[model samples]
Target: MMVDEHENHTIDTVISLLDILIIIQIEDDPIIGIVLVALLKTVTKDRLIRILLILLVITLGEVSEIKS
Candidate 1:
């Protein structure tokens, strides 16, 4: 669960970008799309997948707790 400084920064950046893009038309903004694509490329395919998997696990855990 320990994410290093780089990973932590990346996560924060991704979240911030998502917040911005969600508030508007993401497809309409080419700048945001370019920025997001750049960020995703830097995060790499494996790391992106890892982050999504971690989120999935956390979501499932919360769901199970709610069911209990």
Candidate 2:
């Protein structure tokens, strides 16, 4: 599926922010961090606010998977 520009931007923004957080909290591979962030946005439809909240949840998740 294709995402619109707005959605793409939202995903990009969320992933960037998540990348920063992961850098601070974890010392894992950056590629894994990015993939995790992308997975979070995938389930959130690229909504900016939802992405923000998902960041929090994913950061706190034991498994790094997004939930509704």
Candidate 3:
């Protein structure tokens, strides 16, 4: 069970890295990040994807709030 949790945490970290890349590219107005995130969304499902989505949403909300 601990091993499984560790694996999930590693996967979440990878997803968060991807999301960070997306956020960076979005900030720079780059096209590739948009394409990459779209492709990832199409390929992933359930737990990992949902976690990434929630992280993305929260990060975006925080950035927007900061900007405002």
Candidate 4:
């Protein structure tokens, strides 16, 4: 049981790390952003996707301005 819990915690950490990577990629480069979205689609759950979508929506405007 403890091992199972630890494994779950590890997975959550990885997902969170991936989320951060995706956000950073979106800000830094469009090509990497696409790749990270593909990676996120393969590894993450629907809930994480929805959360990321919301975050992406919120950050898109800000990131666009930064690019200009």
Candidate 5:
């Protein structure tokens, strides 16, 4: 299966838009912070990736300092 230039561009654009939406959602909703934790869990098997992560913590001041 080959993805042509137009198809690749469209896929990238959609991913970028989704990324923006996710960031907005996480910032706007307190509960949405769990989404990041869930994402971190998904990538934990890879040590290199895990070490590079900065975790978020929802607190009185809504601090976001998470660790892997």
Candidate 6:
């Protein structure tokens, strides 16, 4: 039926939008990570190296998860 076809089309459009959003997020993650690292480096001194490493690890993990 026409209504069924329209419904399917709507669903497909929504799914495509979600896919695009996910792709954008994946691409932006690294930029965000870099910015965070830069901010941390500027805001903190050598004393926070451990904190920076931990943050970097967590950010990398999130990126990997998004990729997979």
Best by lDDT: 3
Please give the lDDT score for candidate 2.
Answer: 0.63
The sequence of per-residue lDDT tens digits that candidate 2 reaches over residues 14-46 is 667765676454455667666666666576663
lDDT of 4: 0.65
How high a TM-score does candidate 3 get? 0.42
Highest TM-score model number: 4
Q: Where is model 3 poorest over a 10-residue stretch in terms of lDDT? A: 21-30
Task: Report how far off residue 43 is in candidate 3 (Å).
Answer: 13
Report clashes for each candidate as comma-separated counts: 0, 0, 0, 0, 4, 0
Model 1: what TM-score? 0.37
**Candidates ranked, most accurate by TM-score first:** 4, 3, 6, 2, 5, 1
Question: What is candidate 3's lDDT per residue for 21-63, written digit by digit as tens?
Answer: 6656465465766666666667777666656674676577568
Residues forming the 10-long window of minimal summed lDDT in candidate 4: 49-58
| Predicted candidate 6 versus true structure: per-residue lDDT over 1-68, tens digit per residue | 99989977875565445334333545556566456445554765543463545445566667898798
Off by more than 4 A, model 4: 28-68
Write candidate 1's Cα lDDT for 1-68 as tens digits.
55688787887687555435433434456686456546655665565664564455446546776796
lDDT of each: 0.56, 0.63, 0.68, 0.65, 0.48, 0.55
TM-score of 2: 0.39
- Model 6 TM-score, 2 decimals: 0.40
lDDT of 5 by residue, 13-49 (tens): 6544543444454666745645764575576665335
RMSD of model 1 against the true structure = 12.6
**Residue 36 in model 4: lDDT:** 60
What clash pairs does model 3 have? none
- Residue 24 in candidate 4, Cα distance off native in Å: 0.2
